[model samples]
Target: MPDRPRHYLRQQLRWMRGTTVRHLWWLRHMPLRSLGFWMPVVEYPHLVLALLVPVAVLATP
Candidate 1:
């Protein structure tokens, strides 16, 4: 676990970036019938929500 909020956010960003890159690569290289082609549907929405939660929390006054 991260020792601070900044570290946690940085880790989440890294995970999000890696997941996005992996999805892009899968879209380019994987067949439509493969699990890789379908993984983003399972994973991407959660990542977007993870991203949004932090932003929402920070945006609140």
Candidate 2:
């Protein structure tokens, strides 16, 4: 476990928190069905990308 990955993950989580809050606020005006569609389209990729940070660090020397 290196400082770089920890820093990167922290930064990404901070960004994700802000974006998630903003998106939740925006979603309030939309219909419930839209959540099902948007969750995968927007949220899942962010999650996957965040998860990949660790895998990428592991893959490196």
Which of the numbered candidates is closest to the native, going by highest TM-score? 1
State the C-alpha lDDT per candidate: 0.90, 0.77
Candidates' TM-scores? 0.64, 0.43
- For residues 1-61, could you state the per-residue lDDT of candidate 1 as single tens digits? 9999999999999998997898899989989999988888668788789999999999999
Model 2 lDDT tens row, 1-61: 3369888899889998997777766676666677644674587688888999999999999
Clashing pairs in 2: none
Report the error of model 2 at residue 3, Å: 7.2
Supply the global lDDT for candidate 2.
0.77
Stretch of 10 with least lDDT, candidate 1: 38-47
Clashes of each: 0, 0
The candidate 2 region of ten consecutive residues with least summed lDDT is 32-41
